[model samples]
Target chain A: MSAQTVADKVDRTDRLGIQQPRLPRLAPLGIAAGAAVLAVLIGVLGGLGSRIQWGLIAAILFVVGLYVISTVVEGGRQAKDRLATSLVWVAFLLAVVPLASLIWETVSKGIKVTDGYFLTHSMSGVVNVAPGGGVYHALMGTIEQVLIATVIATPIGLLTAVYLVEYGRGALAKAVTFFVDVMTGIPSIVAGLFVLSLWIMILDFGYSGFAGALALAILMMPVVVRSTEEMLKLVPNELREASYALGVPKWKTILKVVLPTSIGGITTGVMLAVARITGETAPVLLLVFGSPAINNNPFDGGQASLPLYIYQQWGAGTSASFDRAWAAALVLIVFVMILNLLARGIARWKAPKTGH
Target chain B: MAKRIDISGLTAYYGDFKAIEDISMAVEPRSVTAFIGPSGCGKSTFLRTINRMHEVIPGARVEGKVMLDDENLYGTGVDPVSVRRVVGMVFQRPNPFPTMSVYENVAAGLKLNGRYKKSELDDVVEKSLRGANLWNEVKDRLNRPGSGLSGGQQQRLCIARAIAVEPQVLLMDEPCSALDPISTLAIEDLIGDLKTRFTIVIVTHNMQQAARVSDRTAFFNLSAVGEPGRLIELDDTDKIFSNPSVQATEDYVSGRFG
Candidate 1:
């Protein structure tokens, strides 16, 4: 108690005065007032005559002022980091704002046109100058064609990936890998042309949805194979060893353990591939010739997908058709967005429950 | 019940490079045999060879005989998968299958073999987890992920997983090297209990642990450049610690050259 009393008596109260300099509290207010005065000056000088140019200049000045003020107070490093983060957010908003705005505009404007008759009836009997025709034929054709493409691409892509990752040995797998890399870079138009030449010259087959699907599959396979292969590789080798140690057959191990572990990623990748080929207009235009009415058969006639429907309508150059085209484009975008969301949801839902 | 594992002139190679050559030792029934050496001395490699797990590596191969009872493990047309079924391995780090629940991890091997009825699976999972001394702590959270368990418990879950397949021989490669002192003690206690039913072969860098848990110890070394690992000595644990037959073994045990 005596030592504590003596220590308390000797304690230096003046030594603990603030060491770091206090920040200027009036700085932000001063900067804001300066910005407001400059904006008013620019508005008065320009009035309503050159408002857009003046607004642009004012925006630039506002940004520069903010940068100067922040850096002056916060020091260079933190201010730069903050600026970088702000710029990233700005870029993200720039991309998202337009997309959101376009979607909102489309949904509001086209809801009236997006009815059952719009889905069921084609533009076969309706005149192009009028606004009665719907995208029913295009929607049906798109579904049947995309479904056929998925069926064709999914198995071959999955198997190729399995062989590359699991059983790939020596130079053969290397060769396959190299070729797949090359194929991945092939242009969409090139793919369409290749398919057109192959069917017309080699196979002598006429234009049909099946041929279009085959073309899309050519584009789709490399994507699925590459994504699925990477996903499969992510399944740890320890898991395979664990299965082997259990006396489980290799195939069963792949089916039960390996596939289940990677199924989430595989499904997501597959969905992405589906989304990619679903909007492919060049391949369908080249491979499948157009038919006016509903073509339920994929192997028989040229079926118009949503993209082709929009394309054909826009080419027709009538205001009514142009409206239909914009509306159809909106619908297609919504469909793709829904498919992406569905894929992501399914992946998360079915993902093997690994604990914390 | 424990079982004997005999190796006669066993040699292992990776491609053309011999990793371990002409090494022979026997793991006695119901006893622990420790393999101790410095890094890259092929102690773990030799342990892997005994269970035919060496072949899991792309180019690794073995010659000569590793016999369990009267069957030669290296005989022609022998499937390594069947060999692995009878001889389970625990790795240096705990890998309790991050995607599997605690109960599922214990029953992983059993479920892989066949579709078990729920009652049978529940019993087997419980019994194996109990055998590994992890049942009590995890019983309430059996549905939780195996990875959610503490490091020591995760290692124990891995042990439970290995035993769930009813393996006759258990090979542990520095199993407790990644654990803390208390966890190491827990594993050591579990090892002592496990030896009653399975032939135990362990590879360790820790001499104190070798002395503590092993009945017999084999010391390995690789001195000259470009030479395969050679066994320095193999003897009863008591003699190996107190009075070793080889100078290298004495030096290693007494904290000399590794």
Candidate 2:
């Protein structure tokens, strides 16, 4: 019956919602090749210096072409949908391009100096002009400083979040929330300056990795609190009520019901905050007081960190130093990538089971 | 053990706005009393006050004397948590703690009381699930998530969680409203069996459900729009259905008007 109606309405197809045949799988490829050819031709005619301009022009042309083709093949409504989908793909590619290029650049330049020997040994005695050095000491300093910052920041941020989500009611909560927002927007350099003034200037303390860690802690706390508060808010109040109805105390309910429910999100939030702070070079540069030699004591002497090492190597302006800097950049990227992967893995493992 | 409740001059408020006006009633031990009313008639509000769950909302307050077998629930120094422990509640939606396994959702309350061995918890979880008439279906998958079950089964899991700690009173706020007819019947049957063990107070919009499950029914109605809801009448379910004392009760029961 539907087929009969469809056949009868073929002339007046726009009156009803009629299904149209889809584009072939190779259609997009053909459109993309056409776009590329057009872009290259225009680039040649216009004498454009940057090859990047060609890629950008091609992307735009592809999106516009897709909508026009879809409109001619299907209808206005389907064309609009295709336009939306094409626009979304364009947006995704826009986001991915910078990251892809950055990773590609790092890998290409970093492989020159990066090896097993470079990883295990330190730059204790190697001169800036030479090639035999490792990031082991800097890696150690970065780990210790980040770990210390995490240790100091996690509890304060978590407690503040619990207060905001569970028990927040009046002026104090609003004040705390306002301050956290303000803190999040503060420059990392300002935080470093804050630690510099408070710990070094007034207290007469010398520069150390601890000072750098303190600054990073200041940078990390607000992020942790904000992210944690968001995660906590995502926990439905019904769960809290369910726990309360079961005679669970408020604190116990928070610990058992609320926290466990949002544990996956909370872990992801914390890792994101950690990732945000890991590559921060400003505070590390300001407070860490870079040293080439291995420093085991973070509290007493100057130390090395990944970002600081990268900065020093890059600033040295030598072929060898540039190689070292690129290698460190590669290591930092891989470190952050691993942290991201772990966060997602943990989130999946702890995600609440919802359905059969 | 079940306890008789005597409430006198009860009033509930959300900030400055009164929700339920001066209400009074008595509930017998080990019997089902259903509160039937139109929307915003304070049936849910009044039910929440019985266990101090009403105060969970910000600016929500109650003025009343709720005597639970001679103990004043709203009296000075009375802990709301302890009151809630004695008077457990099931909500309108089936909230079976999506984060927990079927076995864990049942054992949650018992664990809150803090002294049960794993073996004791196992026994109580099994019994509670059986009491809710969900044991046969979920017994094999007790380790699975509670949310993995069907909606009706999740509600039963919630029921099991509520009853596991053995509260004297069980308050169900439109427990079957979110369920289908078959699921509603299943819950009604479970409520029937549960009344033998504990005193049950339920708020329901469905007149037939009230008539079927409740021994006594209370009708609540608002005097006018924006006015506090008042208790119109209370009597045996049959009498309330056949011939009510109040005009509004008769009209509401007969579907003349809400």
Candidate 3:
């Protein structure tokens, strides 16, 4: 449009080439190979105790390599930022690799004995070293116990959170808050021991799934309270005042306004708490007594949960029992994964329709 | 139906610190009274006291009498819940229930009372939204979330929510302070129409908004920083704006000082 040739315009193709020297696309691959070689060499020379030590050294080397490479090519400031970014990525990978490998190992070993027969059949009369046993009783027991625990814990936890956030005042509220925080840090085994002493020793009750659930509920209540309290606190005070100003009573306002506003977060929290207690082995071991046969009634007979099944199978110390153990671990992982997926789904579905 | 509010010897405190002290005034039924003042003057706190909402805050207590027609709001046997049922409040920020639909927001207060049929609920929801002048714009999309509306429309929805319960007095605290000029004008017009059916008291930082909407004006002031705020004067909006009695009122009205 200006009626001038392209060469007549001021151009900086050469200057642009020399201005900034970016790291090559293949630089990361090179860094990975270098770190790996360096890790193995140092690990062997120092006689590291575990292979995990090699990974730690490699992670450190990658970060340092990124920082030094960036400093030489880019600048000091950019090198620091790149160093931080690489460190974070290394941290992310550090967390993910263990989790991924765990799942990978479970899947690979689990598929050998994991099938529809494995899902539906039980280990009622099978020998410990035999390979024909299944986890049907354990699955049923896990579902029932978790359901009972959720039912018992949700309302009590929710009401306590409501009190803490909505009407909490004075030293009493402070004491409750402090106790809840302390309860959160109590070990799962301690909760199991408490229920065992109170119910079996004091009341003279026999082992049952109901007794196990009581202990699971104890472990779960503090989690539910802490999470629900946070969620309820997130509801804006204006919504409550709006309902209050409209002449709605306090209880009605809480039911209609405060709870609904934060219901999505509350449900997610509850489900997470459910998932947490679903895999609890210590409580089930001390209370459930780990039955191999199928028992439908949770309040009467001994129960077999997935966590307890895995522990029993692993303790047998045989190759056949090892397969069952890995398969049971796989099933437990899948159970927790499904609960997490369902929780997220409910959260997205029931979340307040606020966005455009 | 609107009712007159007479407040006397009203003093409020947050723990040991006095927020407002010795404020006395009477608001006539079916009229708009505006409280005009600077920041930290306790105009918002005074409005909260009328509905017993100030006590909702921790350590917030009041020494006063708020008489609505024949009943003492702060009497020993009176329930704060019942008092709130008779006196509704709209806050400064537009806060429609984020989880509720536009129709559900209007129906929320009525549903709490729990005796209305579905048809009756529809009628009240339509009537209240109509009363708030938001019926036509939202009638087609009643099931949409209340928060999806524009700022002015959400405020009107909150107004609709307040009026759905058929309260006697409606209190507003700086209702238009967070709005744009056009939205502010819209809220001002809605306030004017709302005064015909409900006694309204508004707190505003903008003097012009007070002048435009209110029939009477009350000026609140503090003697100095960190001191309890007090009512300087209450008079007709024209007299208060055109010629205030106190020199500090004149200075504040004329933008001389905060």
Best-fitting candidate, scored by TM-score: 2
What would the per-residue lDDT of candidate 3 be over residues A111-186, giving only the tens digit for each residue? 7888898899789999878878898999999999999999999999999999999989889999999999999998
Model 3 chain B: lowest-lDDT 10 consecutive positions? B110-119
On residues B64-141, what C-alpha lDDT tens digit does candidate 3 reach at each position? Answer: 899999888999999887888789898999999998899999998888868578878999999999999899999999
Higher-lDDT candidate of 2 and 3: 2
Q: Output the lDDT of residue B227, model 3.
A: 99
Residue A93 lDDT in model 3?
Answer: 90
| Interface RMSD, candidates in the order listed | 1.8, 1.0, 1.2
Error of 3 at B7 (Å): 1.4
Across A1-356, the per-residue lDDT of candidate 2 in tens digits comes to 68988777784665565557678878877998999899999999999978899989999899999889988997798889988987888899889999899999999999888888777777899987677798888888888898899899989999999999999999999999999999999999999999999999999899999999999999999999999999999888888898899888999999988988888988898888888888888988888898898897999888999999999998888999999999999988888889889999999888899755
Error of 1 at B172 (Å): 1.3
Task: In model 1, state the lDDT of residue A252.
Answer: 79
Model 1 chain B weakest 10-residue run by lDDT: B110-119
Order of candidates by lDDT, top first?
Answer: 2, 3, 1
After best superposition, candidate 3 residue A137: deviation in angstroms? Answer: 0.8
TM-score of model 1 relative to the true fold?
A: 0.87
DockQ of each: 0.58, 0.80, 0.69
Off by over 4 Å in 1: A1-71, A101-112, A200-204, B115-120, B224-227
Per-prediction backbone clash count:
1, 0, 0
State the lDDT of candidate 2 residue by residue for B127-235, as single tens digits.
Answer: 9999999999999999999999998999999999999989999999999999999999999999999999999999999999999999999999998878999999999
